[model samples]
Target: MTCSYASRARFHRSMTRPFFSKDRISHFDIFEKHAEDALNQVKGRLKEGYPVDFQDMVCRFTLDSATEFLFGKCVGSLSAGLVYPKDSLPGQNREYANHPSNLFARALSEAQSRSMLRSSMGTNWRLAEFWSDRIQKDMEVCHRFIDPILKDALERKRSTKEGEQSTGHAYAEGKGFLEDTLLGHLVNCTEGKADEIVNMLIAGRDSTASTLTFLVYMLSQYSRVLKRLRAEVLSTVGNSRRPTYDDVREMKYMRAVINETLRLYTPVPFNVRTSTEAALWPGVNGGPPIYIPPNTQVPYSVFLMHRRKDLWGPDADIFDPDRFIDERLKYLTSNPFIFLPFNAGPRICLGQQFAYNEASFFLVRLLQTFSSITLAEDIQTRSPECDKGAGRDAQEKVIVKHHLTLYVDEGLWVRMGEASNSDDV
Candidate 1:
């Protein structure tokens, strides 16, 4: 349902209350289960010495995790199995490539890409699709996958309400009815429950997947950083032991690695917002203030901002997690606005902390399981030259682009060396 900005903000805040609760956030076991499953899938694919599309595997991982968290049942994307580099012997597995969950993921991704294109087109978006609705089919595919789950949730909610009324054990009015999952809570109060759940799936799945993809990509490029990060992971969580919430929190360098990845390859690189009222923005240097009228669409790029030399220092173009931990972190401390991978203010991502936790949990398990990572550049589908830029950008080994979120163009193809017992801390 359509809502005014103020009302929508309130609704979003209320909807996300579950995530803000400490009790809810303490569910690390659920996150770890999905991470372990995804890691095992990666290992399975690499067992034959074939490179796996790590990006695709992580996307499945996040999708399964997000669906389970929001809908109480995972879509089982990981069970579809990991995809191999194109044209390879293993890549010919038509069954794996055409799995139902994989189809749903592709449809969702296509829908997101189309939505982004429409947003970029502004008023002319409709005209481009005047002859036919390009997004309809893909959205139908998505709905087909989600509607049954949503219907089941609604039925469960109805049953619960009837039970409460018959037993005269209705929850107190002020405390609100407690629901076990976000889907239960949403189905209890929202008319557009399906839409809300889908929106959240996009936020939860793609953002974390992108971060993990780039984090791995970055690590593959920098052996020293990978070694140091693995060292920290082993020192803190150890091998074979599942990482707890507190264990993840204690891995400071690992957190820096994640933050650095977010800084360099922000998932939602570009975002737009409409001004609710007239405002004035300070100009650069000593220039006069610039006026902004009400309803003006303001587009911002955290991606570009994150790479600015003046803001992040001369080595801004470089990938160094140390900047986040060393004295150079003072720049970000003094100018907080300079770093905003998750945006800022009232509309900041409600899933920000969840994304951090998910990425960290997965990375910890990954380091524990793998001793080394190398890019399968020989089979990489997208050419690095596709991303045209100077300096460090020009030297990038893989193509990166965005749909609703940043992603490596084809996929982040990599071969991982399994951690031997001797490699363990």
Candidate 2:
């Protein structure tokens, strides 16, 4: 028999599976609608000759949709209509500065930065206590921000127990979701005792947003690729209808672009594995076996592994999505360990498919709405000096930096022009 921890984890996975399943995913049409609302907002601004920071737009879009998927409500970041702050970065635009949601989003960013820094510090991570008091305060803020939703969910569950209408849990129950929605299923599965609400907030928000941010940035830099992608999206999804799960699956090129995006810039660049018990493994170069004592943490860099010259050949560093369609495709089936954006084995992300569905839907909506995106001529690598006029030299290029995930340090600022061939939104 499996141990309690193992069994509990297995049960949790089973409980959560329904929430991210393809069938249940379509029911979350709100994801697509929310994506459209955000995109249209940006498209209107761009039509008026505004160059929007696409990364921040993606962040708000993902935040609103993910929260809606997790809870039954969304923050409506697109509706907040806030501008960039006084000390904002060079390319970033004004953001939605609403209450609760704004504080919640800020807290998420802080906790992720601190968590990344702390993990990188190894055993010295505790030293961050002096610098990371803000993380604690942020968590408190996040909890407070999410508190009312939690209470309402709990009360709804309680009401259902008293034979109240099961609108909250009805769809999930009919479709075999764990509880009703993600929060409901998780709350029910853990007996309403776990501190998982905050965990879900972090898990549901960051990774997907970062992926889309980088993907849009990369798309802007490659017009030929972008043109082809839009063509495929138009042919497959078109102006008349919305894209379904099968429609996205049939989008082979779109799939390739997203795959390449994940390959080149795996959001969570490094993951740490800690051994709970002593272990021995085969040694390298015909040497004797190596020993790994208990409590040892091994860090593997997905960012480096994804771009290995030997694995991907000389053009490993290149941004060619066709590589997925042409060469090296077979190698993935033979050696799956080399590319681990969402990780592998038993701990693979439960939301992986959900993320894919959401992203594909958003891309479909975006390409359908906007014809072309142009990277600003002044775009440059992010730096303290980049904020000044003299710092944006022609030589500067986009650079990747890591915190909880890899993000374009300077931000992806682009100008979107209406598609001449397409009907107006």
**Candidate 1 lowest-lDDT run of ten:** 169-178
Q: Number of backbone collisions per candidate, in order? A: 0, 3
Residue by residue across 1-425, what tens digits does model 1's lDDT show? 11486687677678766655666765777778888888888888788778889999899889998998887788899887777776887677778757899889999999999999999999899999999999999999999988998887777766667768788665443123237667778877775664677889998899999999999999998999999999998888777788877887898999999999999999999988888888999997979999989888888898999999999999998999999999999999999989898888776777787888888888888998998999987877655564576777676888788978999988999999999768843
Q: How far is candidate 1 from the true structure (C-alpha RMSD, Å)?
A: 3.1
Candidate 2: residue 387 lDDT (0-100): 33
For candidate 2, the TM-score is 0.85
For candidate 2, give the lDDT.
Answer: 0.72
Q: Each model's TM-score?
A: 0.93, 0.85
Report the number of the highest-TM-score candidate.
Answer: 1
Please state the error at residue 397 of candidate 2 in Å: 2.3
